[model samples]
Target: MRRAIYTGIEAFGSILEGNPKKNVIALPILQEVSDLPCDTGSELKDLQIEIEQKDLPVDLRFVEENWSEKSGKYEPTSEKIRDRAREARCWLKERPESEIVVVSHGGFLHFLTDDWEDGHKFEGIRQSHHL
Candidate 1:
């Protein structure tokens, strides 16, 4: 029963609830609806634990390979993300039934989606997926 209380609002969130109606997935840095970016390294660590506990067959696309610890953000020109998107596109063309979900920090998300909306501070971005 992992729980979190976001400080500013003094709000509480139950980290994980049992047997969500649909597929439940976590993208460490990429909390789809979170207004704030994830703290460094925590999302990755949490995902590792989730994957291990669930025995999920997730195909991680080398998110950590070129990441910089000091910079605390993905490379501005993310060749890897672009490359993976291309690869996934190619794969999807081969098999349309398959779906690919990318989980990443806001910094990386910016590179991937060209969406740098000032950390989505106000009127946060919304998506079809939730983590």
Candidate 2:
């Protein structure tokens, strides 16, 4: 059984700060490439920088999703989110018994999980929790 750690963007810093593990993975939106103010890139970059500065022992990897030109959206359900879900499912299939930590936007996190339903919303990052 693979344990997943889903968390929003802003809290990634504090979460990594507290957790000293070396096997964490970060999932970022592929189509949405720019690090805009409230986008995934910004948050991921922030966490990356923090990790570098703090010299934490966590290993980070990103999962990329294809973008849809017809929809003109980064994470439309049928396109980006679904692709990410497939990728995660495939990864889980190969390694079905690993604990993975994912730092990404709330919507993407929900899309990756089996328990989350549509229309679910998560507030922006507030505080980070330690493992």
Best prediction by lDDT: 2
Q: Write one digit per residue (lDDT tens) for candidate 1, span 7-49.
A: 2112211322332332223322232222334333344556557
The local lDDT score (0 to 100) that residue 90 gets in candidate 1 is 58
Q: Which candidate achieves the best TM-score against the true structure?
A: 2
Give the CA lDDT, 0 to 100, for residue 55 in model 2.
Answer: 63
lDDT of every predicted structure (CA atoms) = 0.37, 0.44
Q: Model 2: C-alpha RMSD to truth?
A: 10.0
Question: What value does the lDDT take at residue 34 in candidate 2?
Answer: 22
Each model's TM-score, in the order given?
0.29, 0.46
Q: Give all candidate RMSDs, comma-separated.
A: 10.6, 10.0
- Candidate 1's clash total is 0
lDDT for predicted candidate 2 compared with the true structure: 0.44
Q: On residues 1-131, what C-alpha lDDT tens digit does candidate 2 reach at each position?
A: 00122233234556455565544554333222222334434334555677688565444555223222313344343444566566766766676546644544444555566456553433332223110
Candidate 1: stretches off by over 4 Å: 1-37, 43-50, 61-99, 103-111, 115-131
Q: With candidate 2 superimposed using the best TM-score fit, by how many Å does residue 101's alpha carbon deviate from the native? A: 4.7
